[model samples]
Target: MDAKSIKEEKAELEIWQYIFGFTPVAVVKCAIELEIADTIESHGGAVSLPDLASAVCCSPSALGRIMRYLTHRGFFELHESTHKYSNTPLSLRLLLKNGANSVAPFLLMEASPEMLAPWHRLRASAAPGGGSAFRAVYGEDFWDYASQNPAVSKLFDDGIASHATRAICEIIERCGDVFEGIGCLLDVGGGDGTTLRYITEACPWVRGINFDLPHVVCVAPQIRGVEHVAGDMFKHIPEADAVFIKWVLHDRSDDECMHVLKKCREAVPKETGKVIIVETVIVEGEEDEYSDTKLALDMVMMAHTEKGKERTFEEWDCVIKGAGFSSYTVKHIGSIFSIIVACP
Candidate 1:
């Protein structure tokens, strides 16, 4: 009611926003591992802190700090009676083993030291015409490390599969018509055939080829009805009616992407063929919070991997034409991904 009181409340709210935003990322990650969200929900809204700690295999006293932190962040609701906590809608969305928006695996994988280590040298990576952070840290590129290290490779592969499973399912249901009349489909750089499997299942009449490195394909599991072809995309791709380059081009420089696209163009006949590319076309002046996330990803690509980025629609057109394609059609696929079908 008073001017002083209102001013004090406004200042406190602003301070809380900064505090919550900075710390919740770590706490939310911990909650995912502990299944704290599911545990509280299983209790039908509210759960005592002691019971929550017991479910997560942590000492009650030690867990209390994390619980209080999350409660302050609005992920958990604290009850005065028993000092118990309840799940907020935000926490429920992150439950690893369950929930409609299960981003737990993606969070864990991306938040790992292997992925986060590059950020430590982000400033250097952002310097004028710098190389990737992976090269800076490991003295080698991502594919080189993935080929040599099995554990790291498995983690990266599993994380992609987990995210793809959910995302591909939604894409198929929403944009299944895109595959109609597609005869032979080549999945360029298709890691382990996860997307290929989804495509085959959705469009039964279409035959598919899973193309990636020989090493990755050597140990890759067989997917029925889809042929596995391992080779270099820069060299040549097998002939096909349609070439599906999903999330592949973003990991390379403009020259490198042009080379790959040219090779893809050579593989498919212009009159009856197309190259389907799935990636983000970053739009300038976008006001969405996720736009910032896309920019952050672009930096990650710059730091840890080879030249890659979230390009805008104009950039997409320029790159496609640079690769010798006459025109292309872009379609939104999933929340953050887009499908661009380029034809010469």
Candidate 2:
């Protein structure tokens, strides 16, 4: 082919990737729904086509197409000689059967009909005065919709709980110093006290107040050394030696974040207290492993929330300083999010 012709063909090829992206997502969702990974593990981590089809209640021929697609996408493996399929390394790590690192529930939540409805209206949401895509679909914001639908609320809680547990544990492990000398730590916007439970368990010396809204804290389970306090963070935060917020600030605008942060600043003792924040700090155009994931989550925030977003470092600094925090330091724990300590 001529040079110009080759360039045109390459451009077409690259555009096709965007067109084909939804197929893998759909196929993977189907595979997880069928419990394909768990079924394979049950058969000693490998299964033949007929056996797998029978187990998941599909015809062999139809299941074969799914298996072919999944294997090619590297979610599962195909043994050339035996013609059996087994879990790939990626499958084992993300399946619900495994703990902590599993993204199964989160993936299912994102692919759900209710959640996907907003994505369809995303373009309209981006236009001037379009407002939130989620609100457009449900006639209310995401949090309001969750509060009204019990099943959806539980599904989202389960999804976030699965991943947040892992992230919290890593923070306690690597950034233990943040908790040192903290007699009482208030977890702002702590849902159901899960994050506070992990924190108290790790640092027995610390007492925890799981602070959130009345409805959210109402259903929280009892944990020793932790008190579930129901209130609005925007209004008032209970006094404590230190305050910790995990992935909560991202769900607000810069003004809203500063509002919450200023309250956090007030809740602690001005002389010795500090606020700990766990959030993603996006670095634009950086080719790091997690940079893309952070950017993707920023897009999710755009489609799903009014002003929620992941912030860049300078943006974070702006909010921190705007919130009246004098200075702060960030520590990365080898995950998509980082731990930030802001001093009063």
Candidate 3:
């Protein structure tokens, strides 16, 4: 091949990456809004562009663009002979109505313009003494804002539930053995006890306490065989054989995390108890794409909240041991996140 051809090819690949990357996410959000997956699924298996547009109540021209993009991205498969679009593996996983592990909620939550717009103001938040982009733009903290907005709160909760649906399965599969001996477990900041509920149903002998803010717990529907405790993790955590903190610590500063760890230490007995933390330990090596995604998520945490970012193993160890924990174990759960067991 000629030099110009190779350069052109590289440039084309870069352009495709940039264009297709954002376009598909927007299309995904559009699909959610239009209930496209549900519509197509309801229509047997595949649907023509015209039918899909009719079902979704959008113009055929615009719908064609969205469908074409999705098909190219492998979210939907287009049969060349008949021009029908079928749900691909990606769309099937994202189907909101009856998916085995629906990520629709999380996708919708993050991709919404309200959430995505904040990234634009990230530079301002990076200024000295600046707060998170959420606070800077909305004039209130995320939790505080959610407290007043029912729709937004539900969206956030549903997103967390969706996350738990996928991550909890891996957690149990890889770290299921960790729960074997524990009599009781506490899920700190566990919304609606999704993770705990999954665990309790999996292990009938073990009981769990779902601990969170009073208002959050107040709104949580009572799950069978789980105790709902309303309290602040920084101030206190209900006593349990093992305290589980899933996707919680990354949203706080080192100081705040330490305080939380100290409180967790108080909640469980020293000899037999441990604090199980499910979070990303930003490690070197491994799949470059996966690590980059982890780093991007850390930037999201940093941009959206004060004193929050993903940490490394050394960072976690400092906080755990500083909080008086004797030892800790990092278990690769094979999910997007990992588990850290800290013994007091």
lDDT of 1 by residue, 1-344 (tens): 89999999999998988776636667777777788887777887777877777778999987998887777877777878877777767676555446545666766777777877777766766668765777777778889988898877776776676677776787788787778889899999887888889899889988999999987777778898799988999888999999988778988888888999999998998798888888877878775656777787787677767677768888888789999998888987646778888997
Q: Write the per-residue lDDT of candidate 2 for residues 58-173, one digit (tens) a residue.
A: 98999999998888878888998998899988787565444456777778888788888899888756888657888878888888888778778777776777777878878878
Off by over 4 Å in 1: 1-22, 37-48, 71-93, 97-101
Query: What is the RMSD, in Å, between candidate 2 and the native fold over all Cα?
Result: 2.3
> Which candidate's TM-score is highest?
3
User: What TM-score would each prediction reach against the true structure?
Assistant: 0.84, 0.91, 0.92
Task: lDDT for model 2, please.
Answer: 0.86
The total of clashing pairs for model 2 equals: 0
State the displacement of the C-alpha of residue 150, model 1, in Å, after optimal TM-score superposition.
1.0
lDDT of 3 by residue, 1-344 (tens): 99999999999899978776676677788887788888888899899999989998999999898878777777788889998988987887885545658889988888876678778788766888756788778888777887788778777887888889889888888768888898899999998788889999888878989998776778888888899889877776788899999889998988899999999988899899999899998886556546877888898896677778899888888888889888888887774588998888
Q: What is the C-alpha RMSD of each candidate to the true structure, in Å?
A: 4.1, 2.3, 2.4
- Candidate 1 pairs with clashing backbones: 48-84, 133-303, 282-311
What ranges in model 2 sit over 4 Å off?
Answer: 1-10, 97-100
CA lDDT of each candidate?
0.80, 0.86, 0.84
CA error at residue 340 for candidate 2, angstroms: 1.2
